[model samples]
Structures are given as structure tokens and as C-alpha cells.
Target: MKRLKYIMWYTGLLAISACSSERIAPDGETEQNIDVHLAAGISESDNSSRSDNNTYIKTAFTTNDEIRLVNTVFFNTPDFTNENTIFTYAGIENNKYKFTQSSQNDTSGNPDGTGSTDDTQPIGITWNDFSPTSFVYMFEAVYYPGNELFSSVPSDQSNVENFKKADLLIAHHRMPLEDRYKDIELTFHHAFAMVKVEATVPTGVGGLPKNAIQEASMINVQTAYHVDYTATIQNNGLRTVKGIEDENYPRTNVKMWLQSITENTAKKTQTYTFLGIIPVPNPNDPNEPIIVQDDFIHFEVKVDDKTTKTYRFVPKENAIHLEQAHITVLKLQLGKNGVLPLLLSAEIAPWTQASAGMILDEEDPTDNTLSGGNSSDDQQGGNQSENQQGGTEP
Candidate 1:
């Protein structure tokens, strides 16, 4: 068994340490500059075990990963807006994850063994004409693949590589800026729900062959998602995941990609696991019950090398409700009784960061006008997995 991997694209803590100083401006006015030092990786808090071996699998951030920070500094001023700050993960140095400002003009001074061999430096965040004791009320952290924050969610996420990029994570926080030397830990949460289906069958006496399963998928699922901070957003939760309104969005079939196949001879059953990521439902009331409608699990099985059969399973009402940052797992038993739901679990855990080896290595992601700079870095950590479900009408 390869162990359950790709639980989520990103789920971990990002520790940003800052040192403060005062620099005199050309007008002889004092300005506060905070030099950011990056020390980020997966902590022991996010851990999970394999069911068979009880071992752990860790995932980490890859080189060139760019994170965007949008802060709304609250002051007594009448006019106020948000400032977008960008940083790129530039490999490890001095046992700390080195991050550099994406700005091409920033050069590292190599102080305290913090600079990488590439001469990259952590960017300084400066506040001009304001008291260093000011406080920032709203801080938004967003990570999009290639470091590009798309105005809208992509219509397609079928490909694992594209899915990895589209696995958007966002975090919102209210922190005091009085402690300029304090480390700001931004914890990102997934903006979408994950659905994983496992199909199983007994191998003998009226049971199908081990190779019977051919393909599996979810039918009539929401394929597109759109989220924005411009709308009313809660302090901790993500903005409601609104489906992208387009001909290709809000409706499509998502093919469940196979992750692993395992056989338990002692149990006399073989299981096929397939997983897919879906957009969370958008309800008018946050507390209202989520109801799934007209959705179905469609599967194909080979009766023999020359014969194939198709089957579908419609979920009973109240069996599943999808929520952002949560995962639902559905298990089906293939037998003479048709496809029947065997095990259904919901919200086992919010989807977390990616497993090992899925990291992207490309650097210099295209600049979003909101922020800029370029660099890269890498790390090692594990993803938490759980025995973690869907319903459709046939």
C-alpha cells in the first residue's frame, strides 16, 4: 500500500518572525521598518496514521512557493485601504526556511546565517508617517499556485497537477502590530470540500473478480468555485464558496482519480479508493442544513474481459452535507444487491496540506499587480489521513 496521500494540498502553520528598527526619512521624519524572517514547516499538531501499518506520511512546502499577504491597517485616519505583500520561499538556511521578497531590487545582506547562497533577503515591511504602535485589524493570507490570485476559480480541476494549483487556501486574522518583533503565525484553511469514494467487493462465492472495477466517478457535481474577500467574511471562516456562474460551472461530472488499490485476503475483500475535490455549498444562512440533490455515484465494472457493467448509487437524504475545509468519504459494496452504501463518514477533518513529492519547482511565478518578487525553497512533512463520503440519483 502506498498510504493515503494527497489528503489536501496545504494545511500547516507559517511562522513569520520580524525585527523592528527606526530609519529617518529624507524629511527627517522617523519610519518603522520590520524585516521579516521566515521559519515555516509542518508541526506535530497535524499528524495522522496509516490504518494497516500505523506509520506516518509527511508533506512540506516546495521551493519557489509564493505566499501573498493582504493587510488592512486600522488607524484613526479617514481614508484606508489594503496593502498586498508578497514573499517567495527561498530554500533553507541556518535551519530556518528562508523567504525573500519577490521584489527584484531587494538584495540579501547575509546576516546571522539567514541568507541563501542566491543572495536573497527577507523583505522589510515599512510603515511611513504612522506610530509604530499602530494595530492591524484584518490580515488576509492567500496561496494560489504560481502565486497568482485568480479573479475567479478555474473551471477545470480534473488534472492532479492543475488540481494542485487550484487547491486554493486562505486565512484571515486580526493581530496587534504593537509587537513588531513578534512572530505572526498565519494558519491557512482549505477553501473547498473533499470527497473520497472507496469501492469494495468480496472475492469468492457470488463475488466479482479482483480486477472487476474499471472506473469510478461522481455525477452532476459542482465543478467550479468562486470566493472573494470583498464580500462579508467571517473572522475565521472562508468567504462562502460561490460557484462560478458560467456555462461550464456549477454543474459537471468529476471523475474520481484512483489513488490506491488494496486487497485484504483475510477479509476476503478488495477495495478501490478514488478521490475528488468539490466546491462547498453556498447557502443563504450559514447555519442552515445542507441538502444534496440529484447527485449519484457512477461506476463501471468488468464482468469479464469481454463484458462490462455500469451501476449507480443514489445517496439517501441526510447522508451527506459538504462543508468547506471538511472531507466526506463514501464506501460502496458491489454485489448482487446492487451498489449499496456500506460506510459513510463526513467532516473527518478539514483538508490539510499536500503529501510529500507533490511540490512544484518552478520559480518567478508571474507577478500579481497586488504584490511582487521571486525566489524558492523546500521542506519535508507529513499529511494527516483518516477513515473519511456522497449521494446521487440514478
Candidate 2:
């Protein structure tokens, strides 16, 4: 049974439509307060909550989930710096994030004492002494739970909750000061790469159990990332990513959490799906440098939940360069003498809006799945070297 796993919110994009009413200019001073409506479009893939049978339960934003906004390029307003503004999740309406009057505040978009801490009122942008001008105001919004600085990937990603926090998203939009009253929408993009490992034990492999692997992990990969949220405008009125690859990115081992395991009785084999989220950049312009690194796939074969033999494979394409908004699937086949042959492929799909709180599973065929997975780069019989890492814990 093949179905969409994290189809609903994998993009982690937000759509901020202007929902403000018509505000006439004051008698003396011509000024207008920007009432920007906030909504999240695509969410991070995978669900944190699980059922009793270890099946995943799809869920949307929690009550505490909040999005941080920063008006980097705006007309100079009094007493308002480029401090981080926050917007809380109110509810779901029409398959998008919905907010009410109580959830937002009518202010000058100041986060210092002017913003509400309880979320009864969220910070907003206001243009004082408003007038139609040729200048464009830029905004950069980021969605990361707790609004914490992410210097490195979390060591323990056994749960989707941790993955959600580390999976940072960013949106950049430049609006003309004259169009302040019109509807404005901000689209967010993923800043990390999702790696899906599929491990399979081939049929009739002598001296090996049908289900051989107990746990899997990705070892020694770049974990630290550049966290620049500044928006750069090109001469062609388009936005491009601006930053050099940080050489100081720490390389660390990340444990790949098991998503699902299945036994192919007809094929006489077993397969397991594992997932990991890593911070990687797909530079949109030539100003940014590409990052390459070597990653190792580690698997442990156990018997009765005890210590067992371990296998590690170095891919033929050791200089791995993963991209954002994409899934790098590594298909590995285990042979009898711990020899593993690996096939690597990546899939990039257009993001589609999904119904709020919709859960997609293998059993459900009516749900819409992402239109990808067939890649021309997918190849077999790669020159992969296997290394025995000694007996380890399962």
C-alpha cells in the first residue's frame, strides 16, 4: 500500500492575505494602519501524534504554535524597530489558518511592550502618514516553534515534534506602501532537506531473518546552517537567497526514526521506511555557494531486541548535495554477507493546498497524494562500500 505520508503541510508555507477593512484617512493627518491577515498554507510533513497501534495521527497547528514576523524594509514609523512580531494560530477555516479580532492587535507592529504576550492581540504593521509612493516595504516571516534560535539540528529526532521545531520555514514579500490597504499574501518556503531511507532485505538471503534491521541512523552530516532572514531584491524585481555557505557547520550523527515497516511475503523480503530532516540550502541564485558533504547510513540487525551486528554503507555519490523542498530517498538492499548496494534518488513536487486536518494513509485511496517519486536519476548497481561497525545496541 503506497500513499502520501505527509502531504498536507510539508511545505510549511504561509499565506498572509490583507483582511483589513477600508480605513479612510484622518481629517488632519493622512495615515493608515496595516491590518494584515495571517494564515499558514502548507505545513511540515508528518504528524507528531500517534495511535495505540503505532499508526500516525494527522494534526494541524497546536494552540501554542505561533509565527514570527519582521518588517525589514518598511517606511520609518515612530517607536517601532525591526523587532520580531508574533501571530498566534486562531483556528482553521476554508483549509487555511484563520484568525479573529481578538487574536490580532491594532498597533504600530511594535514588539517591545506594544505587542500582546497572551496572544489576545498579535503585533501588526502600521503605516503612519501614509501616501502612495514608489518605495516597497519588505517583510520576512519565519515559523519555528517557541521562536528560538536554531544553531544546530536537535540530537534526538525520534518524534515528529522535534522534527517540527527544527524544520524552519521562511517567507519574504515586498509590498508597495501604496498597496497597504489591498490584500497581501506571503508564501513561505522550506529551509531544510527531508531524507527518506528505505531499507530492504532481499528475498532468499541465506542466514538472515526476513526482518533483519531493528534501527537505522544517518551519521556524520552537516547539522548547522546559515540563519539569515534578510531579503535581497535582484534588478529584475525578484528575490534571491543571499549568503555564503557556512564552513563552520557542525557535522553530527542523526538517528532516523522509523516511519513504517512491511513484510513482502510474495517477494520474500521485508522493507522499512525511515525519515530524517536536515538543514540544507538550495541556493536560488549564483551569489550563494553550494554545500557538499559525506553521509553514512547505519543499520542495526538485532534478534529479540538485544545487541546484534551493525552495517554501514557509504553511497557511491558520496558528495551529496540535498535541496530544499525536496525528499532524498536512499534505497538500500542488504545481501547475505553484510554487503549493501545503494540507490539514491530525490523528488521535488509542487505544493498543493490540502483540507484542514485531513489524514492521508495507505489504506485511503481517495486522498490526494503528491505527484512525484519517479525520478530519472534513480539508478541501481551503484558502487557502494559496506563497513561492519561491530555489534551495537538495537
Candidate 3:
């Protein structure tokens, strides 16, 4: 898979490191940059080939000035180990100094003293507290810097599994002591999935006047979740997720004013498309990650205050859990016909994944703009932070 690249250095970074280090290059070689290829997706899907639409792959370095060498999956020992060799700082010297990935495994994270040449191992590089091991450093991250509270309550919200969407990118691994290894490769899994909704209002329906002004606005929208997404990471990579509410978004039913149905300038045709993040899961058993139902999305029409109709939107599928790094969409179709039963078709794929007859909604704020580059990065960062803030006092 082709590695997604984001060369620009960004600020407001929150890395999951332990302590700071005093190790800086005595020589002037600190300027030479180390190459890090980021694979932020599941292994099943070729991250190399993932399109930007299906995924939002970006980089938040260990620090703005320093690239900390972390102990990840390929480091050393067992099905799930949590001993990190934190290289708070280091500078790569000659090709002889290196960090590498090997097919072999040794408890002692030291380079094979046997002087055997293996392809996966790195050659000619060294760092502080570096250890050579055959273990693979598997990495998965869900970066929800803002508007991401794990648990809140109208009912006992405190015990309700307080999961704070990591304000920073929390990269997990055991730190290896100063050792030499080879080339670096990191794969990232999407901690959360997303879905977008679009409501279609065909003209000449809902007992409206025949002046081509038929439109529907989705108000009081709620993307309720039954499962707590902010799970605690266990030593073995498995998560300890407790049932919790979205503390930041206590009101599941917010207004989807952005996706309201509307007509063209001539006020003739009804727009048939829309988008959104993946809805919350309806977990069948609270203890397990298995989902038995779709997240709830209920809303009323916002265009006309005189019209009072509430619509319930549910995923087409029963189970709704995020596919690591992948997106599961909920496409909605509505009309006065009533016989169609308010259909929602859910499909999982890259961000651009869609089905036949589903029109791309024009209501997206990020439309025509890259999720990473452009001015969207700053705007998105601001929005994330804003979402976490408590509502202003009345």
C-alpha cells in the first residue's frame, strides 16, 4: 500500500510520551530529517492505496522539534506486551546506526550478536536506550482532539465510563533502551468510524402548495450511542470499554441545520443528498463490543414552523461499530409515499464508498477542500476544540 504523506509540520500536537530527554546531537547533524512513513489504517485494507475521501490520514509527530523513537508492536515479546523503551531524544548517525524490524524474536531487545544479515533489520544507525527485538510495533490511534467527551450523564454520568476523546494523539508502545536497528514503518488504525446523512424531499409532496417550494429541514437531530467509544487500552492491545454517554454532547438530538433539504435558486428541484460521521452503536450486550441495533437519529422539520413532523433515522444494518480506519455510511431516502418505510442503506468502505442511486450531498462544509491541507486544518482544529467547551450560560 502507498503510504499517505503529510509533510507540513503542525502545532497543537499532543503526543503520548513519558519524559523529556537531554539527548541532542553534539554535531550539526540534527538538521537531517528522519523519514517516517505513516500507515494509519487497518492491515486488511491496503493503506498505501487508501484515498483521502475514505480516510483522513495525517501525522502528528512525537514533538514539533524531536522525533521520539517509541517501543511499538514490533518491539519485543508476547501476544500483547506493554513495555515501552522511550527514546525521548536521539540523532541518527552513519548508516551503521539503525532501528529495524526483524522476523526473529528475542526477549533481550539487543541486536543479534551473531552478526547475521536479515533483510528486515536496519543497518548503520544508533540511539539512546535502543534495543533490538524481532517484535512488530503495532500502532492504532483515534484522534478526537475536541468535542469528544467519553461519558456524561443525565443519569449517573460520572460512573458512566468517563472516556475523554484523547485531546492529543496518544501513541502507545514500550520504550527500548539505546540500541541500533533498521528502517521504520508504522500503521495506524482508525479508532472511530463516520457516517453522513442526507434527506430527500421530492417536490409536490406533503400536502404543500404547488408553487415549487417543497423542502424539509432536519431539526433536533440526535446521533445517540449505546456503546462507550472511549475505551481504556489494556496492556494487551484489547480495550476495556464501559457503557457511557457522550458527555460533551449530552443532547443526542441536536439540529442538522447543515443538511436541511432545500431547492435551487429557481426554487424548483429538491436536493437529494447529505453526509455525516458514523452514528453511535446500539450495543446488544453492554459488556461486550457486539452491537445489536443501529444508533438513533431523530429530527423534526426546520424549514416550516407550521409543519410538525418528527422523523426517526436508523442505520440500515442492526450492528454499528466503527471499522478501524474505515467508514460505514448511512444513506437515507424519504418521501411522503410512506410505503418505502424511510430507508437507510448502510455500507462500509473507504471515505468515498457509496451505493448506486445515492447522490453526493452538497451540504458538506468541507466540500471541495482537503480534510488535511488548505484552510480546513485550522478550521477543523478549532471546531474540535469548540465542541468540547460547555455551552455558554443563559
What CA RMSD would you report for each candidate? 21.4, 19.1, 21.9
Instruction: Provide the overall lDDT of each model, using Cα atoms, as 2-decimal numbers.
Output: 0.48, 0.49, 0.32
lDDT of 3 by residue, 72-149 (tens): 334322211121322121222231112222212222443755444553544322333333334333333222333243
For candidate 2, write residues 1-394 as lDDT tens digits: 1235344334332211222222343454645445655655443433233111232221345565666655553333212222336666676655565432332444444576455455543334444423332587566566664557566767566676675566666666667766676543455566666777777765453424656577776666666665543334432122232223355654567777778788888767678888877766444454533332222556676523344655455443334455665566666555443332333343443311111111101111233322111222112212222332212111
**After best superposition, candidate 2 residue 129: deviation in angstroms?**
11
Backbone clashes, each candidate: 26, 1, 52
Candidate 3's clash total is 52
Best by lDDT: 2
What candidate 1 gets wrong by more than 4 Å, as runs, is 1-59, 73-85, 91-98, 104-137, 146-163, 180-183, 228-239, 248-250, 283-292, 336-347, 352-394
Model 3: how far is 242 from its true place, Å?
Answer: 9.1
Better of 2 and 3 by lDDT: 2
Error of 1 at 382 (Å): 46
List the candidate 3 regions with Cα displacement exceeding 4 Å: 1-126, 130-183, 204-269, 272-275, 278-295, 303-305, 314-322, 336-340, 351-394
Q: After superposition, how far is residue 183 of candidate 3 from its true place, in Å?
A: 5.2
- Which window of 10 residues has the lowest lDDT sum in candidate 1? 379-388
Error of 2 at 106 (Å): 11
